[model samples]
Target chain A: MNIVVCLKQILDPLAPAREFRVDNEKKEAVRGAASLVTNIFCENAIETALQTKEKLGAAKITALTFGAADAEDSLRKALAMKADAATHVMNDGATNPDPLAVAQVLTAAIQKLGAFDLVLTGRESGDWGVGQTGALLAELLNTPYVGFVDSIESADGKLKLKRQTDNGFELVEATPPLVVSITNDEHNVPRIPKTRDVMMSVRTPITKFTLEDLGVDVATIRAGGDYYAVADLSIPVKDVQCEFVTGDSLEQKVEQLAQRILEVTRAL
Target chain B: MNNVIICLFASAGFDRATQGVAGAGRRLADALGGQLHAIMLGAFTATDEAALAAIADHVSVATELADYQPETCLAALTQLCQPLAPRAVLLSNDTYSQELAPRLAFRLGGSAVADGVELISHSEHLQVKRAVYGGKAVATIALKRNPAVVWLRARAFEPAAPRDVTANVEPAALTLTTNSATRIVERKSESAGEARLEDAQIIVSGGRGLGGPEPFEDLKALAATINAQVAASRAACDAGWCPPTWQVGQTGKKVAPGLYLAVAISGASQHLAGMSDSKVVAAINTDADAPIFKHCRFGIVEDYKKVVPLLREKLAAARQ
Candidate 1:
């Protein structure tokens, strides 16, 4: 089996809320004190790919990404987690391309990489949280796509996928040449890379391609052409004024809090 | 006439979220001076039909759909929508619609936007307002293509008011080619009967500061007194103190309740993303400067352990 996992490098989502800043002119996040890391859901996808490979016993997994130079770190981490190869499609176009544009670039790269049985991506990027790229990629590739899959197992030359739904779960069976977007699950918690593997992964050479090399028109994607245009981008003003409920003792505070709760619930 | 189409899958019947989408569709249709059309897949109740009739000018039902097979539903919608050439295609932000919106847009030569909180119609195109940067920022995106496809966040808009005129109802001529390569083998649904967090008017959410799973029982007791649902922050879920389904955060589930009471949660940006749309927010945390305090309407700076039990007792007594 051949599996390709798409990873995205994003600013650490766990950063303090106050530290988050955005550059309105650029319509992008202002990278301040927060460091960049592989999107947590992308790590879940990588873990899913590794587990699928483990179950299949001989499947080869390739980690692919469309990002700037720093994104190589995410690929290297994927390598440490046992991805067989890494491909970096340098994004020299828009800093924040729309989902369709990203899917187009990834489709070009996947076609260049030849045949693949499976393509996996995180359910959504932690940064934009648009959650469209995977479905868009599947549409562009003309492949069947499944979203919110947490686990995959090989059975009778087919793959059994456990998909999370709003209500519960559905166990699905699919043949090869499929696209699946992985969601985080307890079973697919990302494994920590060993020191030896991390060192070795950093030393391993990664294949690199620019948009031009992949025959994608960077100018077209950067122009924001017929695709949706950003009409406005700004941080929403929160006008909430918190009134602290105070009392002399813990019991007194609880009593006051209970009164407030009653008032709120009564209004509801 | 220019028409706005609301695509709904009624596998579990038309839900409150679906009604909100229909309401949003009504707004769009009125803005565009167009008819509101509803295309429902799967079985629907008479109440669902009447609900659609209240808002929609035309209703099309495809009851042959057994389950939400993405490919088949995509095919059915693509086929149904080709002739309508809708001004905009609206859907609820559910798992099925999230998968369908983009592909259907691509197939119909349109553009798709997901999780829209607001939709505005113009002479030529539609603009959608959606949260980006994990709710820290909102971006207004203008759809430039035809049949602007958009999925709206649940509970973002009021349900459509009942109209005096009944809608013209018809069966949708759906051509479904099942993709034999992919099939659902088994399905499991969470046992129902408990109030869902999304529908709960009041929510009591905990976080890492709760220490462990034991406190959740107290939280549950407090919730039971007021018919509130229990939720947790990502930290609590990650620590294995609660089920992942109970998590309310950017990555978990977005909930907009009437009153949200957060206990011992430091209020990370991601957690705020899920509940910020709440009408009222209150927090109980020992930290005087927990980020949650800044966003909440009321706060108590005390250890939840000391406050929760007494508060539950008082609430139960008051309710009685």
Candidate 2:
């Protein structure tokens, strides 16, 4: 079996809130001081593919990403964790592409990879959380797609998937050559690479493809400057006032907290 | 003939959450001075028609679907919008809409903006207000194409109040093609009868400060006293203290409830992205400097074990 897991490098979603700044003039995030890291959920997607390979022996996994050249770091991490190959869809790092453009570039890159039994992506990117790539990729590829998949198993030459919904979980089945957007579940947390393997992963080869190579124009895949305009970006003002209860004892603090909650909720 | 369409996903009947989408769609359509219409695909009953009639001028119901399938739903919505030449299309920012909105935009050759909190008319163009940089900043976006598809954030708008109005309920003309790539085989509940985190009026969430899963039992007890739902931070979820489905953060489900109570949570920005829109927030933590204090309206510096039981007791006594 062959699987392709789409990985993305994003400013750490776990970065301290104070570290995030936006350039309103440019209408994009200001990444001057922050470091980039693999998106948390994309790692889960890679783990999902790896776990599938573990259960069904003799599998090849490819880590694919569409971002700046620096994204090779994310692919190396995937390779370190056991992906057999890596591909980077190169993009200019200056502009932040919208979800649609990202999906289009990914679609083109996937077409360049020839054939694969499965394609996986994070349910949503950490930064935008638009949650559209997998769906648009499926549409562009003209294949079946499912989102928010937590569990996957192979049965009778088909894929059995468990999707998380607000009410509960749903069981879905599909054939090969499909796309799935994965969300992190207890069973699919990414494995930490061994120190020796991490060291060796840097020497692994990564194939690079540009937008031109994929038959997509750089300008067509970018957002905000011409296609749409970001009128403004600013810090939102919080309307509520936080009242810190001045209670020396634990019980007093608890009581005061409860009383204030009731007073505000008009429950008493 | 309405020039604005709101696609609703309903099975058996229109879900209450879809009403919120209808409210947002109506607001945008009204602001644009365009006719409002609704499109739905699933088991549609008369009750669903009546509910939609109160909200939209016309309702298109596709009764051929046995389940909510994004591909088929997109096909139906695309067919419905083609003839209307709609100015905008609205969908609820649920799992289904999250999947369908972008694809629908692509199919229609338009642009999309997801998880928008507010919609307004700015200089004759529709602008969307959305949170960026983990809820720390807001960006107002304008689209350049027609029939712009948008996923309105849940609970961000007032659900349109029901009124007495008769609307035409016509069968939608959509040719849904079956895709061999995927199909849903079965569905089972994770925790039956528990309040859904997205729909709950009040939420009681725990964090790593709880130490283990056993405290969630106590947390659930307090949740029961107030008719609130139980949630956990990403830390608790990642530490295997609770199911990831119960996690509320940037990676988890976004919720905007009437009141949110964070117990032992440090208020990371990822967690704030999911619940900052909550009408009122209160936090209980041993650390006074937890970032959650800055975003919440109330705070108590104490261990959750000591505070939770007392809060339950006080709330119970006040109710009685």
Candidate 3:
């Protein structure tokens, strides 16, 4: 089995809110002192791929990413986790491309890489949180798509998946040459790579491709009006002033809080 | 007339979220001076039909789509939309629509945006405001294609008011080919009867400071007293103190209830992202300096252990 996982490098989502800043002119987040890390969902995807490979025993897993040079670090982490190979599609144009452009670029890279039985991606990136890339990529790739899958197992030459739904879960079966977007589950938490594997991952050879190499036009993607454009980006100002319920005793405070809760619920 | 098509999931059965999307579509259609068209997928109740008829100028029901088969639904929608040439396609942000919006947009040669909290309609285009960077910031995007496809966050818009006049209803003209390569083998549903976090008007959420899983039971008791749903912060859920399904954060479920009562949570940005849309926020925490105080409408600086039980008792007594 041939499995390919798509990874993304994004600003650490856990960073303090005070430190987050956006450049309105550029319609992008100001990176500033924030550090970059692998998107947690992508790490979950990598973990899912690794576990799938482990179950199949003979499957080869490849990690792929489309980002600046710094994204190599995410690929390295995936390699340390036991992926067989890695590919980097260098994105030199817009720092953040819309989902359609991303799907187009990823489709080009995947086609250039030849045949694959399955393609996996994080359900959504931590940054924009658009949650559309995997579905769009499936459309562009002309493959069957599944979203919010947490686990995959091989079943009689097919893949069995545990898909998360709003209500609960569904057990699904899909043929090979499928696209799936993985959501995080306790079973798929990304494992930490060993120190030896980390060092070896740094030494591993990674294939690199440019947009031109994939026959994708950077200008077309960078053109603002073709698909969608960020008209404005700003922090919404919330003017909520908290009224603290004060009391000398805990019971008094609880009484006051209950009274306030009743007031609010009654208004609702 | 330029029509705005609102897609309703019959599986969801005209819930508030569906009604909210219909309201959003009605607003867009009014802004465009166009007709509101509702396309109901799957089997719908009579209440669903009446409600859709009251809000929309026209209603189309595709009963053949009784279940959510992505490929089949996509084909049916694509076929239904080609002749309508709508100004925009609206859907509620749910698992099915989240999966369908982008694919439908791709098929229709349009652009798709998800989780929109605000929609701005211009004479020739539309703009969407959505949260990004874990809800610390908002981005307003302008769509550049025709029939802008978008899914709106729940509770962002009011549910459509039923008008006195009924709309024309007819079966949709669609040719569905179910050549899906994927099939569901089985389904496991969570036990019903408990109030869902999204639909609850009041939510009582706990976080890392609650110490352990035992405290969540106290929180649940308090929630039960008020008929609210119990949720947990990402920190609590990550520690396995509660089910991940009960997690409310940027990566988890986004809930915008009438009142959000937080306990022991320090209010991380990701956590704030999920509940920032809440109408009223109240917190009970030992740390007065916790960031949650900044966004809350009411706050109490005390240990939740002492406050929760007493508060629950007071609320129960008041109800009685």
TM-score of each: 0.96, 0.93, 0.97
Query: Of 1 and 3, which scores higher on DockQ?
Result: 3
Top candidate by lDDT: 3
| Model 2 CAPRI quality | medium
Tens-place lDDT digits, model 1, residues A3-103: 99999999887777677777878888888999999988899999999998888889889999998899999999999998999999987667778888888
Q: Write the per-residue lDDT of candidate 3 for residues A66-148, one digit (tens) a residue.
A: 99999999999999998999999988888888778888888899999989999999998878898988998899899989899
Better of 2 and 3 by DockQ: 3
For candidate 1, what is the TM-score? 0.96
User: Can you give the DockQ of every candidate in the order shown?
Assistant: 0.74, 0.61, 0.78
What class would a CAPRI assessor give candidate 3's docking? medium
Off by over 4 Å in 2: A222-229, A247-252, B11-16, B43-49
The worst-scoring run of ten residues by lDDT in candidate 3 chain B lies at B191-200
Indicate the docking level reached by candidate 1: medium
User: Which residue ranges in model 1 land beyond 4 Å of their true spot?
Assistant: B12-14
For candidate 1, write residues B1-320 as lDDT tens digits: 46899988776466667778888999888988888889988757888888788789999888876577777778889999889989899987677888889899999999999888888876467899988777888888989888899988777777889899999788988777888767778878663655445656789999999999999999999999998989999989989998877888888878778789999999888898898888889999999889998889888998898888888989999987
List pairs with backbone clashes in candidate 1: none
How do the residues B50-165 of candidate 3 rate in per-residue lDDT, one tens digit apiece?
88899999999999987777677888899998789988999987778888899988888889998898899863668999998888899998888877999988877888778898
